[model samples]
Target: MEEDSTGPDAEVGAGAGRGDDQSMRGLVEALARRGELVDIDRPVDPRFELGGVLALLDRGPAVRFTDVKGSALPVVGNVLTDRERIAAALGVPKSGILDALSAAIASRQPTEEVTVAPCQELRFPAADVWREVVTPTFFEKDSGGYITAGMIVAHDPVTGHRNASYARIKPLEETTGFVGIAPNHHLSALARSAATAGRGLPVAVTLGSHPAIQLAACFYLGLGDDELEHAGHLLGEPVRVVRATTSDVLVPADAEVVIEGVLRVDRPVHEGLVSEYHGMYEDYGDGCTLEVTAVTRRADASVQVILPGLAAEHSFLGALPIAAGLRHALRGFGCRATDLAVTLSGGGRVDVVVALPPEQRKQAKRAILGCFAAVSMIKQVTVVDSDVDVWDAEHVQWARTSRMRWERDLVLVPAVPCDRNVPMQQDGTVTKVGMDATAKPGDRAAGNELAVPPRETMDRVHGWLTSDGLGGKVRPTPVVRGALHGAHEDGR
Candidate 1:
């Protein structure tokens, strides 16, 4: 991930694991406890070096930028980059994340409204926000600094229901900037409704909320559904929300920073070189602008920024949510999906793999259809037996190689709708492929049994490998025919 090697060599800080505290700071402290955190106490330019440093640390540990050159607020990254880390954030075993998310969706608890919010500890009315607030350029190819991690809290103009979703906000001035929004997003529909009514849509961009809130915001619920309610269930309590200073929008009370603004949907500006989940840049063009009205944050705020586009952190955000959704959808189809994995090379939005028990092999087709039906962006689907570790890309490929016959196991659906991020997308559609990689009835004849030592021998070997005297006392050199190799190299 250290694609750019021009950054400085800084001091390393300790762990950045997750713990009982649901707050972003708490997550950082947990990482600190586990010695999985990288703390750069030295100064690093947010515009140039910060993103590179984060990219280099991708999929490894959480990073805290103690001193961001000109900014007073410290920045943190890579908190939700992998499954193990995210499972820790929710205080659940990795296997339980899907069930936890499903429960939250079904049994949502309402949020608590409060008058006092830590985010409002210090407040400023409009203008000079780019300098005062947190906006970092993740890459040099980026057109400018962006709010890569903030959740846009807005209300649907037609239904008057609140919406929380992620979008890219590039600050061009003290009060205004371009917002990259997908046309199909609920927030975009709300903005369009507001534009048709000849009114501006008010929004409060919340940064550095709890991981539960961040994950819940990405749920593919209905337009009017309150994601905060589901977030509360994930946290095992209510999420406190406070009214925005400039609008009626309710922002997370415990947020690290909140930029209250009204989006001007009628005003569309060209967004140059914006990064996509596919780890590439595309000129999406015509990004809507937001007029910053007020900024509120903690006195000693620690801003949270996502290393967007291709990074593990970015891909995991999209992948984890999809995993939960696919699991739920499959259950309704009479197939119990054991686990799911999104191929990282597919940018977490293209390829999906679903795992099932050997007994559920008959429902493989149902599981495949459930995936493609639930998510239009998925390009490829693979169904494997539960024994296959879905998370391991190599293992998934091996399952297909060992168990599947291309002619019989392949299911191809042509002219399916695909997202623009896919390279093969043509005329708004692409061909979808599904592979069934479960053991067949007569597979044992070919190579059903793997080549390995007996179970008793393997257990004894494991004990020997872990024994204290295993390395130092074992001076045996294996003999090839009559010659003894690796002998007397250490004067044995």
Candidate 2:
């Protein structure tokens, strides 16, 4: 409800401190104190063990595993598995999540405190600690074990702006790992820019962190914006940061695990078949390698794993991007956009349904095109009148059937930038389709029509049926017959 701000008492909770020690770890402990955390103490395998836990915990509570196979330290996953957890993490109601997230995005300011922080609680310089700290975990079938949840913190060489993002880390050994840098993702773009100047970029991959930091890393922010500030906005406080032991980049003071490294441009390694958010495995060969400079962690740390092809992963990774793009597109087209939902049915990113005012029929087409342009992954969009609830699948389908004419209402755009998971991409190109299912502004058949008795009459009918013990046999309303049946009744 309140706008974003930063101070000693930045309203993290009703009365919580905004110190470096009060990071996501503190929030999790608070949730645990409130009985919101579920600890799965049994020994679980890392391969599918975390994924299984995530599937059960989806939209539920955060889980902490005390006994991971071959490790005394616990493994924590599904911190942001559902809307409720995300709301809890942000200290907001689930219904108001988008607004709070938008507020966080809008109001972000970097911290000026230069004191040593908790993230540097235990530091291992690259040369001294590379082999001892950077441990890799395998997630998929054909890919190398990766630093699945690593947040790579770096500074843009040209602009000298700090950037933090999530990228897959493929293990080369104990100290060094290969990073899969996609072409469009911000970190990859930054790496390319630095590489062109023939300089290796310094980076730190934070393996375990609070949900706020993870959410911030997943977001697509501006070049100069500090994700730590965004994390503070999400948490409704200022995020405390500490300088990395080897690199100049700053990381969350309370992060569970941190790997300070340099991404060497000259040396690249083959990294492939890694699981992606698109619910598919992508083969990215020889992207870049992160030469580990330092690794730090809490004394009995917990490893965090992101389950690939999971609901929470898809929703958190895709929701904001789609929502921002859709919001911008609808507003740009002069349509009174009431709501937009990216259906989980389409892996939480591809299929979207937008609700708009009935009068803005033509604007729906424009909104659809704008959405496609904004988020390249969206393949199909259905526009419905505001009366039809976009969140209701049955209502949306009914509107599509009743109001949409495929030949006349469907708009097709070809050779669009498709989601990498699209099975039908010829060469990174795909087709997008938009269906205008809203009723025409002045069309006589544009509205829903139902001929029924008054509420009292319906109630009386129901009462009689129940009194006679024929409730099961009685229909709520009569089914009208054709003209022939009506003629027969008239003749009788």
Candidate 3:
């Protein structure tokens, strides 16, 4: 069936139902065919080389690097480059992103089973192929190359349900790497559960799969909600998975590289000063170590790289989270917020702009506070009336200048919890500012004031004089006599 590209159903149709034969490679091929994929032939290093490419592709399509120093396979990056590309990837209009993403989340269902998987096309007994694969080149002064794009898929040992998470892995040896799982992240929670059971947590880190699956991994799903199932929901199809050769976890059937391993609970490795999404560097102490028992991949396969602290990476990572949170918050306030946008210039998730009806002015302020609460990283929010387009910066600025009053409409709340990267904050706390840019209700009727139109209207008499052949006989609207509040006026 032909899908409507401008609606929510189109985005949902991308993930409705499908099989294992569709791999990450297939999606890349489709994007490439659509002229949404660019390949760089010049030799580029993994560290700064990929960053430069990502900057160019930030508002465009995915990039494929065919000429890395020592790698025979290509390295693709920036699959979800911008909001427009994200809309294209999800099959929705750019303005309908929040609605489409929320719909996908609401319609998520459990994943279906599959027997044979393409990801297991070739298996290497940890010793053979582990040394051949190149580690991700994210930063220049890092201890070693890290796997920044791998989605570590695991199941809760207690509940037996699955989860997917994006975590960085640093190669310590040929068969061992340090996986940094944040303290409160889902994978970390699962790891803690396994530790209580006196066993290592089994996991499979899948690399270079479909963009939908990658997005699903990054989504912050609630407890018992499977990310793989969410990925299926996003793709408008079910994802195919096969049981790992060495672990109880399931990996994507079309994944390029699957590193099946177990997280050693007792053993830990020093991890940080790694680059973060905030466009800053932070040192995270000791992270879990993974002992890779087996490695699976296709022959002559390409790897994916994620550039940290950049637009392409941050936008793709932060878009849905910010949008979904804003949508939920605005709805909670009983505001008819039709659209929400977090600018890429504001580090992808910090500065937000919301569009709502002008009559609901109080709801706008509540929506702003709700956004700040939902994503603590956001430092400033601007609420615009529906008459003023939020997506257009010029229109937003116009509304701010013309409609807003300094003391009457601006709301300031101090000492709120802030993200680590906010420049104006002190020790993770700062003052948040919200501007109510909606037009003041009944300003004209309140006798505040009104300005007269500067242009003079022409009558039929003037029109006849200014008619095509008689144009020179008539003069245009006379220039205004003087400035309303000038020190001096010149008579013409």
TM-score of each: 0.87, 0.79, 0.80
- Models sorted by lDDT, best on top: 1, 3, 2
Model 3, 1-492: lDDT tens per residue? 011143222332244344434455655666776677888999887656677677766767788988877665688877766555556556566555677667666667666557777688788887643454566556665666777788899876666867888888888876888988767677877887887888888889888777677777766567657888877766777777888898778888888888888887578899758766666677767899888889888775778777666566656567665676567656766776756767655666677878675457668788888888777778888887654545455656766787788788788999997655564678769998888876666755664222323323333444556565674455321111111111011111
In model 3, which range of ten residues has the least summed lDDT?
A: 481-490
Q: Relative to the true structure, how large is the alpha-carbon lDDT of every model?
A: 0.77, 0.64, 0.69
Best by TM-score: 1
Model 1 spans > 4 angstroms off? 1-22, 444-492
Candidate that scores best on lDDT: 1
Better of 2 and 3 by lDDT: 3
Q: Give, for candidate 1, the lowest lDDT window spanning 10 residues.
A: 1-10
What is candidate 2's lDDT per residue for 1-492, written digit by digit as tens? 111222222234311335435445655676677676799877776556656677777667778877666554676666655555555555565445566655666678565455665556665655544343323344547465555667778876665777878777766766677887766766766777778888778787776666666766665566667777776766555666777776677777677777787887578787767766656666756688788877787775666666555366556656654564466555656765666777766666677888776457678888788777767778888987665656456767877887787888999888876755654566788888899987774445445432334445555766787789876565321111111121222342
List the candidate numbers ranked by TM-score, top first.
1, 3, 2
Error of 3 at 28 (Å): 2.6
**Position 92, candidate 3: lDDT:** 60
For model 2, name the residue pairs that clash: 119-253, 125-293, 126-293, 130-175, 269-286
